[model samples]
Target: MFENFDDILNVDDVAKALKIGTSQAYKLVRSGKIQAFKEGRAWKISKLALINYIMNQQ
Candidate 1:
């Protein structure tokens, strides 16, 4: 579904994809609602993980 985004997405990318605020996106990552891993101090989410999260939400 997210064909326009990169395979690896950042918080801002996720926010745009979900049409939510960056804080909300961060909350998802922090709360483990969306699967993510930290690279240094930033969160990285795979495109497949995002798709899976969306699918599971429905």
Candidate 2:
């Protein structure tokens, strides 16, 4: 639903997109394996960074 690069996606979106668990998505963000930024009390991941990570994985 979020299409802009400036938009931030929450853990649930990332998990659903990547087909991973919510806990795993949080772990990736916390561990620096995936890029995320803190917005208020929540973590937000950039669409660009997520795409880059997927590309690199392949």
Evaluate all candidate structures by whole-model CA lDDT and list the values in order: 0.95, 0.81
Which stretch of 10 consecutive residues in model 1 shows the poorest summed lDDT?
A: 47-56
Candidate 1, RMSD to the unseen true structure = 0.6
For residue 26, give model 2's deviation from the true position in Å. Answer: 0.4
lDDT of 1 at 18: 96
Model 2: per-residue Cα lDDT over 1-58, one tens digit each: 3363345678888888788999999998899888888988899998877877788898
> TM-scores of the models, in the given order?
0.95, 0.82
Q: TM-score for candidate 1, please give it.
A: 0.95
The global Cα lDDT (0 to 1) of model 2 is 0.81
Candidate 1 clash total? 0
Residues 1-58 of candidate 1: C-alpha lDDT, one tens digit per residue: 8899999999999999999999999999899999999999999999998998899999
